[model samples]
Every structure is written in C-alpha cells, then in structure tokens.
Target: MALDRRWPLALFRGAVPVALGLLLWVAVTGGEQERQQTLKGRRAADLTHERRHNELLMAALREAAETEDNVAHRPVPWRK
Candidate 1:
C-alpha cells in the first residue's frame, strides 16, 4: 500500500520537469527559426542589388567593346 501511494507522487514529480524541458526546447527552436528567416531575407535583397549592378556593368562593357572595334577598323592617317 505504501509503495503504491509513493509511485503516483514519484511519477508526477518526474513528469513535471520533462514537460517543462520540452516547452523550453520549443521556445529556443522557434527563436532560432525567426532569426534564420530574417537573415535569409536580407541575403536575398543583397543578391538582387548585386545582380542589377552586374547587369549595368555588362552593358557598359559591351558598349566599350563596340567602340573599340570601330576605332580599330578606321584607316590610319599615314596609310591614307
């Protein structure tokens, strides 16, 4: 009878800490997920800005190349 009565109390005591620990774990994981999402958004914005800059640079380079080709094909004054 004494052992049976003690078993319920012991089980309750053990379950309380386990339940609290699980709750704390969930809170920590949720915080980490929020931080990761914020970082991902910032990184995506940075990449978009970089892509736009690269496209502008590529256009400028193409224009310069065309100008260089035209200059090279011109007749030299001495040759004329």
Candidate 2:
C-alpha cells in the first residue's frame, strides 16, 4: 500500500506562515496611521501659533511706520 504523503501536512505548511504574515501587516499598518494622525495634529497647532506671531509682528511694524510718518511731517523748530 502506497501511503498518501502530500495532503494534510503540505496544505497547512504554506497556509500558516501566510496567515501570520497578514496579521502582522494589519497591526503595523494600524500603528503607522495612528502615528501620522498625531504628527498632523501637532503640525496644525504649530502653524496656528506661527500665524498669530506673524500678525503681532505686522501690527508692531504698522505702528512704527505711522510714527515715522508723523515725525517726518513735523516742522523743523530751528528753521521755522
């Protein structure tokens, strides 16, 4: 009687590693997405802060420009 030697062991031999690899892939993808979301949130906060700082600097510059214009338009006391 010839023993059938390629059924139960051969089918499972290839399937187990493929199944384990798929599980590992799913876990790694989920972790990477979570990390990307965290970085995006931090980037958004940093941009908001930078915009506020730029606005403050613009207001100070405007005030200085107005002061300079006022001084330039004033009459010279020694000549008048």
Identify the leading candidate in terms of lDDT. 1
What TM-score would each prediction reach against the true structure? Answer: 0.45, 0.47
Each prediction's whole-model lDDT (CA): 0.81, 0.81
For candidate 1, list the clashing residue pairs, or say none: none
- How far out, in Å, is residue 6 in model 2? 25
Q: What lDDT tens digits, residue by residue, belong to model 1 across residues 14-46?
A: 999999999999988878978999999999999
Evaluated at residue 22, the lDDT of candidate 1 is 100
Off by over 4 Å in 1: 1-30, 69-80
**Whole-model lDDT for model 2 versus the true structure?**
0.81
Q: Can you write out model 2's per-residue Cα lDDT over 1-80, one digit (the tens) per residue?
A: 87678877987998999999999999889789789999999999999999999997787567767764554455676121
Quick one: best TM-score, which candidate?
A: 2
CA RMSD of each candidate after superposition: 9.4, 9.9
lDDT of 1: 0.81
